[model samples]
Target: MNVLRAAIEVARFLEEQEVRYFMIGGLALQHWGEPRLTRDVDVTVLVDPEDLESFVDRVLERFSPRIADTKPFALRHRVLLIATDQGVPVDISLGIPGYEEEAFARAVWVKFPAGEKLRLVSPEDLIIHKCVAGRPRDAEDVESILIRQRLRVDLDTIRQWLEAFRPIIDTHDPLAFFEQALTRARRSLETGGDL
Candidate 1:
């Protein structure tokens, strides 16, 4: 479905609309860690709930919403699922009130293998996202990123954010969970084992 091209097109559209956004999820993981097959493009758009409908309308001009009531769904869940004409899925996360603005501020531009430049979440921020998701596969992705990034990633920042999200997400002991996951990743990397 030409996911890369679709990503480039979506990025360009967001840029044209002057939306502060960044690529995340699978596309981002490829940048920070091991490359893997990712069928969809995930992005975070920094916009308020009030303005979400306008954003959705603009996006719908090009991408088809996967759900019938995309606007209300996005306002409720803070995510909009859509697909390109070619059927490549795009998951757009409506910027959460506090956390997303900071993530957008911390985003840096990265050039993709196909020569398209996209703003992306920092490795530390990406780690926090993976931790908060808390799926086994998500943890595995975090481990891969941890091993590849090593000390270059800012652990303290990631931990602080995770701590801040703990109460909000109802996660118990986020730091401990992160440490445990990181330890497992370290062991795997050290043993030259697959994640």
Candidate 2:
């Protein structure tokens, strides 16, 4: 089967098992407004020890997940990488201590393949996440989404989030930086650059 179908099957399994997950990453941005191609599907789920064990069990049974225990010594949790039959990776985060609530609350539902419905992190949340993550790829992804979607993302909402999660961004003028990014994205769109 194709990657999309694989992801849908996984989502279906998750739903059937009553496990909650918030879809994040490139696919989610594409759904919002930006169009981009990404190989894997990334999901952030609320996971405790019991939830993690149950999820791992279900995923292994359903998809034959090949797990990698890659947690740091200081971290209390770990990430489970479940590779699909099509070789698409699904990164299931087992409980991020700080941002669990916001991640769940900001999820916006979108239609999946085969007429299935699933929740994805909002564009604003995606922006916040990428910025906080501070990875080069994340910046590029954010730029692509911002330009293509012309999201009209609520500046205040993003600003508030940054203010609340200041440590993550590691910058004092997050609002200004966010506005600058938005402006650059709009300019790129106006100039007909991959919008």
Candidate 3:
């Protein structure tokens, strides 16, 4: 099955099991503009230990983890990564102090196949999270989304979030980096080049 269909099925499964989740990662850009193909699905949720255990169990029941990793190298948070059989990945992050409420508050409803509804983090939120993560791939993903969905993005929101996290990203200068990457992406797109 195609990844979107698999994503919808995962959302349906979460709903049936009463597992709350928000659509995160690159796929979320589609809500604001044209769809982009991502290798896997990324869902973030406020999962308590008990809830996480249950949620992970439910996911594993349907999509077995083909690959699992718990690397020693840590970034902002320690994460358990699981690659499922359906070409959908599930990254379960333990709660951080402030991100839960912010994510829920910022999330907007997105309708997928057959009018199925799921909450997705705003583009601004997605970009901010990726920027904060500071992984090369995350940065690239942010740039690609920004370029492809520039019209749909709320620049003010991105600016605000960037300002709020200025202290953390000061060294990386994510805002400046974002703008530069955006320029490059737009040029590439115009030239029919890949991001």
* Local distance difference test, each candidate: 0.84, 0.69, 0.65
| Model 2, C-alpha of 143: deviation from truth (Å) | 2.7
Candidate 3 regions exceeding 4 Å error are: 68-80, 83-87, 93-97, 134-156, 169-171, 179-195
Give the per-residue lDDT of model 3 (tens digit) for 57-95: 555667655454333321224454655556666665544
Clashing residue pairs in candidate 3 are none
User: Candidate 2 residues 1-195, lDDT tens each?
Assistant: 355665676677778888777788766877865567777887777756555665666666666455444333113446667777777777766656556677677788888756877778888888887766756666677777687667577667777877777754554445555666777787887887774
**Candidate order (lDDT):** 1, 2, 3
Better of 1 and 3 by lDDT: 1
Please provide TM-scores, in order, for all candidate models, with all chains considered together. Answer: 0.91, 0.77, 0.67
**Which candidate gets the maximum TM-score versus the true structure?**
1
Predicted structure 2, TM vs. truth: 0.77
Best by lDDT: 1
TM-score for predicted model 1 compared with the true structure: 0.91
lDDT of 1 by residue, 135-194 (tens): 778777888888777637887888889988888776456666689878987787678865
Window of ten residues with lowest summed lDDT in model 3: 68-77
Each model's number of backbone clashes? 0, 0, 0
**Which candidate, 2 or 3, has the higher lDDT?**
2
| lDDT measured at residue 17 in model 3 versus the true structure, 0 to 100 | 74
Quote the positional error of residue 147 for candidate 3 in Å.
5.6
